[model samples]
Target chain A: MSEAPAVRLVEVHKAYRRGAQRVPVLAGITFDIAAGEFLALMGPSGSGKSTLLNLIAGIDQADSGDVIVAGENLARLPERLLADWRATHVGFIFQFYNLMPVLTAYENVQLPLLLTDLPRRERRAHVEHALSLVGLADRMSHYPNELSGGQQQRVAIARALITDPPLIVADEPTGDLDRESAADVLHMMQALNRELGKTIIMVTHDQRAADHAHSIMRLDKGVLWSNPDDAAAVQPAGQG
Target chain B: MRAVPLAYSLRNLWTRRLTTVLTAGGMALVVFVFAAVLMLDQGLKDTLVATGAVDNAVLIRRGSGTEIQSGIERAQIGIVEAQPQVALGAGGTALASREVVVLIGLAKRGAPDSVANVVVRGVGAVGLSLRPQLRITEGREFRPGSDEIIVAHNIRRRFEGADLGQTLSFGGRSWRIVGLFDAGGSGFDSEVWGDADQFMQAFRRNGYSALVVKLNDPEAFDAFLLGIESDPRLTVEAKREPVFYADQSQAMSTFLTVLGLALSIIFSVGAVIGAMITMYAAVAARVGEIGTLRALGFRAGGVLLAFLLESLLLSLVGAAVGLAAASLLQTYTVSTMNFQSFSELAFGFRLTTAIVLKTLAFSLVMGLAGGLLPALRAARMNIVEALRAA
Candidate 1:
C-alpha cells in the first residue's frame, strides 16, 4: 500500500436546500482512508452516509472544506473536469444496481470504456474479462430484467471495475438482494478489494454487510465516529 | 468528451415502442399533408410546362394571357407563316398551326348534374405534327374538314360523350369523336381537338384564336419574337410555347402552394406539441437512467445529445411514412379548374428528390423544436437528486 491516503476529507460539510429550508446532511468533519483499505460506513436513514459517499465519489460537491480522492482535491475541480476525473479515477456501485435496462450485461459492463479511445476489439476483450471476473461469463448476453438481483449487482461491479479506477464507492450495494444474493455480491466485492488491491468505501446500515470491510465507521445526525466501539455504543436502536 | 452511444438512444426508443409509434404517427400525418401539397403544385407546373415544345412559339393578341382569350386574324397568320424563321414541313410548307381555342360546358363523368368547362381546340392540318408528343392511343385520327374530333386521354376519361365513337353536342353542332389521343401528360390532354376550318364554320368564328409555329432554329427565338412584335401590321406578341404554358399555370400553382403550406403549418403545430409531450414523458420516465448515465461520467451535453438523437430518429420514421403515402398519389389522377384558363385540367401528383429532401428537413425541424427543452432539462438535472429518484 502507498504511504499517502487514497481518500482524505478535510472538515467537509454538505447541506441541501428544500424549497426555502436548508437541511444539513454532513457536518464539518475530517477523515482519511489508507490506500487499498476497505472501509464501511454505517448509519440510520438520513445520517449523511450516502452524502459522504457521494462527495467522496465526486458526484456531489461539498458546501465547505476540501475532499481529496486519488490525490486530486474534488472541491477545486471544475464540473466538466470532475466528470472526466471520475471516469478515470473513481467507480460507483449503487443499491439498485443501476444497470441500463436496455443494455445486456456485457454492454452495461462496457459502457464506461466507450469514453476511452480504445479499439472496438480491445473493448470487447476488456468487457469479456470484466464479466468473467464477476463469474458472469455465460450471462453476458442477458439483460438486467432477465437476471437475478445478485447477477445484476455483479454486472454493476464489473462495470465499476471496467475502467480500472483507483477508488470504488458502493452505496448499499446488496440492499435490494436476497440473503444468498447479498452474500454472493459481498463475496465478489471482497475478492475485488483483496485480489485486485482496490480502495473501497461502502455505505450500508446492515452490520453484517459492514463486517466484510477491513474497518467500520458510523455517522449519526451529521456526525461521524471512527472508533468502532464508540460507534456501536452510540448506534441508534433498530437501525440494523 | 465522449458522446452517448447512438445505440443507447435507439434502444430507448424501441423500449418505449408505443410512445414512439404514436408520436411518429402524428408527425407522419403532418408530413403527408406537407408533401402532398408540394406534389400537387409540382404536378400542376409539370403538366403545363410540358404542354409546349421548346422549338414552338405561340402568337396571340398583344394583351391576351391565354389562347382562349386571344384572336389572331387570318392576314396576321399568313404573315407569320411566311417568316423565314418558321420551320418547313412536308411539301415545303411552313409548320404553322392556326388554332381556335374555345370552352364548352360538359357533364363530369361521375357527377352528371355538375358541369365543368372543357377546352375545345381546333387545329390546322399540321397541328398534330407540330406537337410530336401527341399520339393516337386508340381509334384512328380525325379526317380533315370533317366534324370528327380526337379527344385527349384525360378529357375522354373525365367528361361525358368524350369517348371514341361518341358524339358531343357543342358550338351549335354535334362533333363525332373519331380517336383518343394521349398528350404525354401535358396540358393539351385537357382539350378536345378537331379541324380548325370545321370548328370555325360551326362556331361562326371569323379568325383564329392563336397561331402555333415551329421555329427553324430554337436558338433564333429572340430575333423571331422581335420581328413579330415590332411589325406595325401585326397586333400580336410572340412567346416561347413552354414559357406561355408555364405562365398559364402560375396562378393555380401559387394557390395550391399557399393552401398546402397553410394546412401543413396548422397540422405541424399539433405534431410538434405531440412530439414535445412524448419527449417530456420520456425524460420523466428515464430520470434515473439519466442520472445513472451522468454518474457513469457521461457529461450533460452527452445526455442532451442522446435525447435529441432519439427525437430525430422518431421524426425520421414519421417522414418516411408520410413520404411513402404521398408517393402513392402519383398513381391516381385528379382534375381541378385552372383559374387562369377557367378550364378543367387533370394532373397527377409528382414526387421529386427535392420534395423528399424538403420533407426530411421539415420533420427534423419539428423534432428539434420539440426535443430541445426536454433534453436541456434532462441534461441540467441535479445528479444527487436524480440518483435518489432511482
Candidate 2:
C-alpha cells in the first residue's frame, strides 16, 4: 500500500464511430491497480470492459483524459514512444490465445524477445524459462492448432511473460475454453499472480472466473463500480 | 532497427506456396524479357564494334554517314596514302586499302524464297593486312584481277552459292568463291570480299566506298584525321575505325533498346498488379497477426518494412530465375538486319555486369511499387479493430 500504484487512470474516456455517429464506449473512468495485486474487471456485454483493458495495455488510446501505466503517462506519450514503453512495461493476453498459427509454441513465445537487444543465447534461455513456467516446455515445437485450448492459452501466457514485463492485461483469458480448460487457465493465472507477484488486470464476463483475482471491479453501461461489495455479489447485477 | 528475421518472410511465403509461386512467376517472366533485351542490345553493339581496329582510321565522303553511302575517287585514295601519318608495311607500301561496299540480295539457306541483303566488300592483300583478325579458314584468297571472291565463314552458312568453290553472279559479272574466312565474330564475318579494281570494272563504278588506313604511330590518329580533313583538294571525313563502327551501330541499337524497354515496361505492369493483389490478400488474411504484432510493440515502420521485405524476396526470387533463363541465350546466335548497312548481322546474346545490375534494380522497383500500398494499410491498421476482427 505504501508503493505507488502500478496503473492509474484519470477520467479516461473512449468512443467508437458507428457509420459517422459517435457511439460512446467508456465515459469518464478512473481507477488505480496496486503493484503485485490481481484485479479483475467484470462487465456485461457491450460494457467496454475489453476497451478499458486495451487502454491499460497501451494498445489503444483514450479519447480524453489521462492513462498512466507503470509511472509513465501514456495519454501524453506519442504513439512512436508508446510501443517502446509497452515492450518494456506491459504484456497482453487475448481471448482466443492469438498464437501465430505458422509458428511453433517456442517461436510464438520468442516473438516479443525479437524486439529486444538481448543476445540470441540469452533470448533462448529466457524463452525456455517462460515456456517452462507455463508447463508447456515439452510442447515447444507444437503449433497453436496442434495444442488443446488450455495448452494454447498456456503458450500465449508464456509469450506474455517472455518479456518479463511488470504489468499483464488479459482480455477474456478463459473465454474460448471448456469448463475444465477454463479452470486450468484460471489456476495458472492465479499462480502467475501469487507466485511470480505480477500485477494483473483481467476483463471477464464470468464472475466465477473473476473470483480468482484478489479484488474485483465492475463496469456497466460505460460506468465503473470500483468495489464489488457496493452491489450484492450473488445478484449478477449487470448481466444483460 | 534490426531487420525482421528473413525466416519470417520465408516461412510466410512457403505457407502460401500457391500465391508465392504465381506472383513470383509473373515477376520472373517480366525480368526474363528485360534481361534478354539488354543482352540482345549488348550483343549487337559488341559485334559491330569488334569489326573496328583502334589504330586504323576510316575515310568517307563528306556527309556520308556510312561506308555504303560514301565515295572516294582513285585520286583521293592516292592523296590519303601519301599522308605521312599513314603507316608503311614491311615492303614499304602504305598500309591502306581502297574498299568498295555493295549490298547484294541473297536467298536464305532454309527458306529459299526469303531474301536478305549481304554486304560484298572489294579489297586487296593490303586490306588483309589492315585487319589481322581476319583469317582464311579454308581454300585460298581470290587472285587479283580475276573473277574470284571469298565468302566469310559465317556468311557461307546463311546464303546460297556462298560455299568455297561455289559460283555466284551479280553486278553484271560472275565471281567464283575461292575461300572462306572468319572475322572472329566481327561484322566483317557477314560480308564477301573480292578484288577492288575487278569489282569496280564489273560494277562499272569509278569511285571507292571508303579508304581504311593504319596509323604509323598509335597516337598519330589525330594527325591522320587532320591531314584528311584539312586537305583543300578533298571533301572527305576520316575517323578512328572504332568510332566509325560505334556510330554505325548507334541507331539500330537504340531502336532495339527502346522497343525492348517499352515492351518490358508494359509487361511489368501486369506483374506488379499480380504482386499487389497477392500482398493485399496476405494483409487481409493476416489481420489478426498484424494486430498481435502491433500489440507486441512492433512500430508501424517495422510492420511496413517486414511486408515490403516479404514482397521484395518474392520479386528477387523471380529475378534470379529470369536471369538464369536469360543466360541460356548466350550460347546461341540470332541474325537481325542492321538498318545502318541494310545487311544481315549475326550476333549472340551478350550478358554484361551492367545488365545484371539493371535487371535487379528493375525487379526491386516492381516489388516496392506493388507492395507499398498494401504495406501501408497493414501498418496503419488500428490494433483494437484488427484484433476484434475474427
In terms of TM-score, the best-performing candidate is 1
Expressed as tens digits, the lDDT of each residue in B106-187 for candidate 2 is 8989888999998889985688878988899999888888889998977899888788888988898888999999998788
Model 1 lDDT per residue over B170-210, tens place: 98999899999999999999999999999999889999999
Candidate 2, residue B333: Cα displacement in angstroms equals 2.1
The weakest ten consecutive residues by lDDT in model 2 chain A span A231-240
Question: Candidate 2 clashing pairs?
Answer: none
**DockQ (C-alpha) of model 1?**
0.73
Off by over 4 Å in 1: A228-240
Q: Quote the B-chain TM-score, candidate 2.
A: 0.97
**Candidate 2 Cα misplacement greater than 4 A, ranges:** A226-240
Q: In model 2, what lDDT does residue A174 have? A: 93
lDDT score for residue A195 of model 1? 95
